[model samples]
Target: MNIKEASSRLGISARAIRFYEEKGLIQPAKQSSNGYRTYTENDIWRLQTIAALREIGMSLQDITHALAEIDQGNQQGLEEYLELQQAVMYAQWVELKRMMDTTQRMMDLNRQDGSLDVSHLHELAGSARRLREARQNWHDRWNYDQQAAIHDQRVQAGKTKEDKPFSLYHNYDEALEQTVQWISPVSGEAGLDIGTGTGNLAGRMLNQSAVMTGMDQSREMLRTCRRKYPQMHVKLGNFLALPFADHSFDFVVSSFAFHHLGPEQQQLALEEIQRVLKASGTSRICLTDLMFTDSAHRDAYSRYAATTGDAEQQRALRERHFPLLGELCNWLGYLGYETKHIRHNELLHTVLAVPRP
Candidate 1:
């Protein structure tokens, strides 16, 4: 349809549509005969998404970013964008409510006394602004972004007394090699490594001639990964929601990053792994991280931690989401995949999955 038709269909003015195009929000094809712009159904839907986001107070820049994320294979991009906007609106609500409460308190003061004190009102408003500003900023508990630079260095710092946090990283190098070996990379095959911090696991497969794509949640880690393997593909994504199309890779692997997710996210991540792998029977999923042999193993570890009175170890044990080996296998089985557990050590292990017959 022509610009007029699109504007009519969208119930938006042609000028507004032109303005959106000027902001690089949409690109309509030009008719070959008259060079007139034409909009397709996809373009119209894109425009609708933009309009909806703008209605909710998203800046043009924010809308552009959300659209780009969707282009990059985040199928849940709209939901994620809405969640971010919700956070922003919630912050704005706090600021507005704080100001409103201060106004009410000032009104209360006037009701109790003959007149309002301008200086006292100013102080209350200032305090409210400061508190609202402080409450608006959110920080990650792990601080992975800040730690990206030294992530490779601190993996097996070996500074622990006996039991320590992230003991899975203790055999980091060996684990990476074993994971790569387990993958048995074949030339010309497409492979993806999730939570591929600093390209540790992905880089090991360079000589195997397989096309490797590394994905991580931390941008700084991706920067380092790019520096380490310039030819390898690197993407910014998390486990629970992958930024790739369905059935996109021949095999999928991950290293040392899955434990960061909670139980539900872990299960969701498993489904995502299954979704992204190709339909061929030989397609596989391999993962390496800290895991218990089973429920009994987890109980023994908890009991050992308590008996030792090592406060730090106990805290680490409490904080980490170490999966049970049996649970992982069962989840894979339920997902139509056969799973094999490989224990590298008492605390470190790997799990490989292939589609069941």
Candidate 2:
């Protein structure tokens, strides 16, 4: 039969048959006289098998390799191929089960309050789970020796404020101006700036509040803060595992740092914030990163992020910085913080969440 006849009989498109040929899964019988392609029952069976395997997620390379082995009269090839497909199917089934389990849990959360749906709860659970994992990893990896090495590295980098082309900070400053304008900072007893890079917020709070503490994981960053704002108390710490006691601060704020972490880290940090803030305290987390609308920002941000790290570490470093706003919000809410305000205007996006009073 001709290619068209075989394709019509199989109830598959001619285009798909051509694609299978391109992938080296099936070869049409070549004709010499008019150079017309011919298809036999063997080819039809092969195409059907290929289509079935593809529907079950067999990759092009695997299909092609298996076809070659089968053509070479290797009887075990078909068995091996089936086994590979079975393994993939099992893995997919496992993932589907996990998704269903998560979905069921979400339904329960939503049943408690009809305001949230599946997507919202899924995001929350995923974020919270990831946070626990990251915290566990950090606890396992951190030791006195690692801390000493980090401290030494901080000392070696030296507190030099060179002209680094960081667009994040520039955008952050713009956002901060707009945020402070709309909601005036009502002075509280004390405030904490979690992950206070360069002490920008802490610097602003120094004069405005009774006492302000800048908390960051990087000693180098705290050193920079110490140089610029001697009055504000700076401590090296992680947001996920804050060092302060419960109800330690009246107000907690983080600027453009939450997205650096995955959903898990953000939620853990949120729970930590909830644990530490006063009952009536407020928390504002300012997020200044690429929005869902800003496609160009990722390329620019990625290229610029490369300069901050050595060549060996640039790719991983860039991956760490970029995150979507929706995921960030889902994490915040899942960790039990009420999202009071969310603003995304121009290129800056900010979210403010307060613990339940």
Highest lDDT model number: 1
Candidate 1 lDDT over 285-321, as tens digits, reads: 9989888888899999888778877665676677667
Quote the positional error of residue 103 for candidate 2 in Å: 24
Residue 178 lDDT in model 2?
50
lDDT agreement with native, every candidate: 0.79, 0.62
TM per prediction: 0.62, 0.47
Per-residue lDDT tens digits for candidate 2, residues 1-357, read 987898889988999888877867788888999888899888989988788878878888888877777789875556556555654454344334445777687767878844756677768678646544676554312233344334434423422324533333334455655545433456655778877766766677665654888876654566667778878877656666666666787777776566566555555566677767776645444444434323465567566656675442354344454455555566767766666444444334666665555
Candidate 2's C-alpha runs over 4 A off are: 1-132, 136-166, 179-183, 281-317, 340-347, 355-357
